[model samples]
Target: MNGAANIDQGLGVSIDLRATPKPGSFYRGKRHAGLIDVDQKGAFPVSQYWEPIYHDDTNEIILDPDEFYILASREAVTIPASHAAEMVPFNPLVGEFRCIMRAFSTRLWHE
Candidate 1:
């Protein structure tokens, strides 16, 4: 299936993928904080570390190899409570790509 396809299995329903990228959703990481203080707990705004991505006149986002960007997928995914989702590093049909998942040490969440 493509990026926007819905998979149907027995009594399970797959996630629905959208086509348009959300506006003002791209953020780039300023720098990697090697270690986070688990003892300290407070408001950890995403803006503190990530800044809004600047697009060119053509509205194209050029990625920097040295920086990490939190890109919003054009697809919207909703996983069922009884099921789980996994990221595929690469899809042959889509060519070369990499997917990395990280768990942040913070109470505040943003989607």
Candidate 2:
């Protein structure tokens, strides 16, 4: 897997992604152009998905080679106040817990 990571920090994890987004879902309400905050909710159905590997029965998805996807977390984790934790990598190249430390690092906590 081709990903970006910082070993000292914890790995980034995400549960969902906005892959191949559904065109119909966006054109339904506003009738305007552009995007809405809710559109980023990883709503792409199996039909709109183009990933080479996808689990139709499991609802599990995998991106194609060299493709980027928006990630969503399946669960919530909290680092206690005044405490710092490093994200450990899991599976080396899969799952939501990868690295995307935009606003991450030591501090209060994250959800």
Candidate 3:
């Protein structure tokens, strides 16, 4: 899903909030969203999007100048056969927080 017009390629802004404690606040199914641009070339307008996380349970909270509020998922999902997914945590220097991808099932696909 990589695109030249993608926001990530326009702002040079990277988010690293994993250091912040998780399950900190008890939210009753509230969603939070924001936007980021990575190009910084001044060629595109502010690229924005909504990132809503389901807040239900309570967990430890970490307060840091570089930390952002923790979020949780609301609904559970299941993948059907011939398809799979991966949940990779965000590494500011490497990937995005909500990065998701399809996984291949070698044996099942061959069978």
Candidate 4:
């Protein structure tokens, strides 16, 4: 599903991805592992790395499925006054996905 909604100034944009029934495995150097990277210089201190996951039950390490993952840009971006930008996802996984892009004084959010 693709659509657009107005985002008011001073309010942050929010996005939610539907949970998969069976989460896939997330591991570096493994087949079907989810990988992400930021093109903006200095956006990510570490150019490449595995994404972090939080354990919901015992607070122990829980491997997230490879079906989906989230990544954020390390570089902070400032939107000049009177200017707006739109974020569009290229070649994303199929089946009902949404991408939200907002301007921050010095940051970019991706999931």
Give all TM-scores, in the order shown: 0.53, 0.31, 0.20, 0.24
**Residues 25-94, candidate 3, lDDT per residue (tens digit)?**
1112123433324333333321122222332244333333332333433333445578544544546675
**Local distance difference test values of all predictions, in order:** 0.51, 0.38, 0.32, 0.35
Clashing pairs in 1: none
Best of the two (2, 3) by TM-score: 2
User: Which of the two candidates, 1 or 3, achieves a greater TM-score against the reference?
Assistant: 1
Worst 10 residues of 4 by lDDT: 20-29
Instruction: Tell me the deviation in Å of residue 100 in model 2.
Output: 3.5
> Judged by TM-score, which candidate is best?
1
Which portions of model 1 miss their true places by more than 4 Å?
1-24, 32-42, 91-111
Ranking by TM-score: 1, 2, 4, 3
Task: Give me the candidate number with maximum lDDT.
Answer: 1
Question: What RMSD, rounded to one decimal, does every model reach?
Answer: 7.1, 12.8, 18.8, 14.1
Residue-pair clashes per candidate: 0, 14, 9, 9
Q: How close to the true structure is residue 28 of candidate 2, measured as C-alpha lDDT?
A: 15
Tens digits of lDDT, candidate 2, 12-105: 5555433443322111111223333433444433223322232355555645444444333444555557966665656755643434432321
lDDT per residue as tens, model 1, 1-110: 45744555322322112333444356677686444454445545566666876554565666665677666544455555797565544456544434333233234433
Stretches of candidate 2 exceeding 4 Å from the true structure: 1-58, 93-97, 101-111
The candidate 1 region of ten consecutive residues with least summed lDDT is 9-18
Candidates arranged by lDDT, highest first: 1, 2, 4, 3
